[model samples]
Target: MRRRLLDIIHRFYLDAISRLPPAEFRRTTGLARGLHVGGHCFGPLHPVHNIVVNSIWYAAAFPVRRPAGSDDEDEANALLSTDGIARICHRSLDGLVAALRDLCPSLSNGDALWRLFSTSADLTAAVALANGVSKSINYLSKVLVPSSPHEPSVSPLMLSAQVLDCIASQKQQFKGIGNQVVNVVNMALQQYTQRSGEQLKLHSVCGASLLMEEGLENCYHINFLAYHEGSGSAVGAPVLFFTEAIILSCYETDIRLCVPVDPVTDIGCCFACESNRKMVVHPCYDEYLGGLEFQEDEVDYGSDFPSPLDVDYIFFDADRDSAFANYLWRDSTDH
Candidate 1:
């Protein structure tokens, strides 16, 4: 699921970049840096973490203590370098930040992370590692345990103790909400940021889950957590895939309890209307899921997934004074 999500985001980001004129690429990169520095948080992995936290993770997992005169040193050194990952990182972030700015101007903060559009070595290293992890996982999937036509290999395990601890702590932190609106939004945001990084305070963020049932039956519901007056912010499809990837990383093990039915669906959030809070299957949504392909009879997955253009921003409002705490996605697109 993580690999699938990465592929979805990667394709979406690259496609979006490919669509842009070469001259606009610099502006897009600037906008992306602005969003990152301004705290425009995605699910869990924010742009800051792409440098800060990832640096720590990399250092801990692979120390720089290579044996003298050993080729292993070069390999380790290369892994720590950001030379190759720079392109992918810029492409991915530029697409997301630029699209959000175009779709909803309110989210921008005008503060670029860099003076101009350029990749930092730290960022390159972080993104390089992320891409490497995705590719490694994909390769392992093909070589792992095989299964019959009726069943597939067990999925990957999500048994990170750190992740479970975060979930428990967040549940406790949000248990004080009393109002329905605040409560709903609180829960949804919690779900969206489950395995990623610390939750950001934003009203435009929301979450949705796609659950597959027996046979080909599937369920899709939007979780309207963040709320504000006016309308909800638009979320590009790449954001959706990224959020899903974060959620999929939280579970303990591969869900193999059922056949012909997916063990789980992705839970992700973006800006949405108060009216969309209710759970129902819309025609556009069904078409969206059709592209995901859950079974043999299911439609073959396509290159296109949900894009920001496909969403309709509607009014979002909740009790601001309620005991439950919530963040709002502001109207500016600067950051």
Candidate 2:
């Protein structure tokens, strides 16, 4: 009866996973695909549900091998002899099974079995599990309660919504980090000008410029680079096209001075320099206005500074132009 109940619970979880929207299903299945037992891919026909379930079962059944020797035993000689190693290995397997039996007592209890299946399928329960609260029956009971009384006991849609909320929270934190970096850079530039008696302007490139043709603004960090242009035609006159002025602010901030290594293969690296840190300033001295050329600093104080480590870099694929683009396409099509 217990075995039958577990099977039914597993089937219900599988049905919930299958019922997820195509995009959510793809996202969840992509996570599941990371569970390659021996670096083998499950072909297209293999159901993602089966892969995830079997992986969980395999992990639960085969816990880590514990050392069989006592505290005083020679750790270095533990695996010296084949027969001795085999004996220790067998003992470790036996110990793991016993440990699991003790940890999960009374599988015959339907409540215990239900708790196991429900927690496995619940994202919130996973978070609780990380904090060592999932094992508490009272906590699980409270957590597993449906938001709406009429809603199903557990659903993939709910889990997906939780995942999205977590993602949004993380994105906001990343944006904060980028903003902090920009503020720090600008303050440092001001300090440099005060000490050196030379004014340096801050020109910020839009985050969208760093993105691909239709990339999303999901970067988390900004970059910085500097260039000074000198005149070749006249002495002490601002150069038309010379490139060897050492911008002190650039050096003080440790910004990259050289271009990217490979433009095509590592275009992101090139753009990383362009969007966050690249500064091109020409100091023109004239007789009319006390030899001071005032150039308007074009600073993008908006929340659009691109990051060196964008979402595209994280979820890159050779077949797809961008994972974010695919997500947008699927989202629009679904709507």
Candidate 3:
């Protein structure tokens, strides 16, 4: 349930920014080279929020079935279901706020809480709007309740007519602080969702770009290298790319490295046999996915490396598991 809530909230934010004008879109999400947090910007953004937003964006952006039509609307158009809206404001608005208040107790003395809000002003505003909505809903629920026997009979159509008449006739006037607060709360559902969605996409793209860049530079061949960042327990594994789709990946105790010359057998072998002893093979298709693990022994750079007939030097890492070292291996004749 928590997972589903996060997913819905994520998609809500992503679709929001995708509909923005191209210029605003780029300014918010543009990439840069540096130590960054979410998207191209660096700040005190929480890592959990960053990871959650990025993961959601990754799934939405690279869906199993890429929707047909304009790129922007492919996945962002739908609003959350009625159930989701109910969840957001569940219980009486006052009840929900009271529950939240009980959990936090105080926000002013909390240095961490202040820091979180200070880092993201928009988030702070969204939170404030949420509070205002709770109060308004609580008040409305009480005042709008049916009165007793002495009250004039109010027909369903008469109530509907009154509502439509007010909406059609009265120009909404934002008067003083009270009306301003009300306006913000009313807009929170639309505004907050949009803002969050864009943030998620930006962060996700930033992370993916980093991994993809590494894979592209190291992975052999440019024909079609598909970069896949590991998640969960497999996170420690080397970043890897495959020229083809992966069908089955498993740990193999004994496997033969087919000779490069044999197209049929070579195709059967996994792309990079890192130290993990895991094997990923494509029985029916060409694409495969695997890790880029390296052995412990230091690669002797002093000695010359044998050049392959036509293949280019992909990557070389010495002291693979523990330390980081770069080694250059090139043969003039091999190229």
Candidate 4:
């Protein structure tokens, strides 16, 4: 059943990519590649994990392009409209959730976890709306501020006030949805623990945290850090996959955030001794990690076995790069 679900997910993912506009298709594929590279720095993830998260990220970050004569108000209204790629992705995600519910009938009985999956469509739409508003505000800011001394200068404070005023209603709507999302996430986590007999901790910086830490009211710039008790010794594949999925789902969504630092390279560079020539460390540490004597022995699995529990122990393979590239680039002109 799990393998069948994964196959359906893979097909849905490909269909979503195929339906995207040409430019967005390229951007989505590029984002997926970037995720693969960044994730490989930490550990190998199942290919389906990458596919699922990439689809979500692309949907969330999908922009609302304003018509040539359309005003900011029109664009804002359009953002909330049930149309375009965001809506398409929402349908695909809904189908995916329905399939899951069908496969696991237990989830249909007022399950909080099921509710989370259902509400994610709204969350994705909210994120897209936030992105649209952010872009609109940015555009207003540029237009309000004089580019040359010949024009009258606008006060920075007044500019900010005006921008905030313009998006006040939209901000309120987004805030309401954001609050609901947080509540749903909490309930979902509780439900997850009850069912799996495992407690997952989520350390997130957004909403109130953003206001407290950076005095930024931008709710789109979210960061999630999660772990389980076993994370210290050996992270379970499911935990790692879900963590990556959640983080990637929120990434590049009007946040304009910095790339996360590579932990292994940072640690090695900071702590390595300069006296030992053999101890020299570089950013490319994949070889060193592979050569470590303490590394676990990997069995030679000749076939791709996607487990029912969605935990697949695997290693990164350089040979797969070409195949991935081909897969992403194939049928590019069709859309």
1 versus 4: better TM-score goes to: 4
Q: Which stretches in model 2 have alpha-carbon errors above 4 Å?
A: 1-159, 205-309, 312-335
Model 4 lowest lDDT segment of ten? 307-316
* Candidate 1 residue 121 C-alpha distance from true site, Å: 16
Model 1, residue 148: C-alpha shift (Å): 11
Model 3 steric clash pairs:
13-197, 14-197, 244-287, 244-288, 245-287
Backbone clashes for every candidate come to 27, 6, 5, 0
Question: Which tens-of-lDDT digit does each residue in 54-93 have in candidate 4?
Answer: 5445445653465698654411111211233334334444
RMSDs, each prediction? 25.4, 24.7, 30.9, 28.9
Give the residue spans of candidate 1 off by over 4 A. 1-44, 66-226, 231-335
Ranking by lDDT: 2, 4, 1, 3
lDDT per residue as tens, model 2, 139-233: 44654663566854532222234334544555676676556556544554455456666434445422322222123232222333322323522
**lDDT value, candidate 1, whole model:** 0.32
Candidate 3 per-residue lDDT over residues 1-335, each given as its tens digit:
32433343344434433532433223212210000112211112222343334434544454344357635532322333344334422221223234334433553333323432333322223234445442234433434674576976543322234333333333232123223322222233224335444111101100011012225332221111112223422223222222221112222111111111222443443324322122333232443333333343522324443432111211211223111111111111233
Tell me the deviation in Å of residue 73 in model 1.
19
Q: Give Cα-based local distance difference scores for all models.
A: 0.32, 0.35, 0.29, 0.34
Which 10 consecutive positions of candidate 3 have the poorest summed lDDT? 201-210
lDDT of 2: 0.35
For 1-335, candidate 1 gives per-residue lDDT tens digits of 22332344344334433443443223322222222232121212434443333333433454446467765312111121132234444554554445334433444423222211222212222222334443234433433654457864554433334434433454554443113323333444455455454333334324344434332232233323222223444242112211211122222212211111111353212112112332222222222321333343333324443422112111111222111111111212222
Per-prediction TM-score, please? 0.17, 0.20, 0.16, 0.20
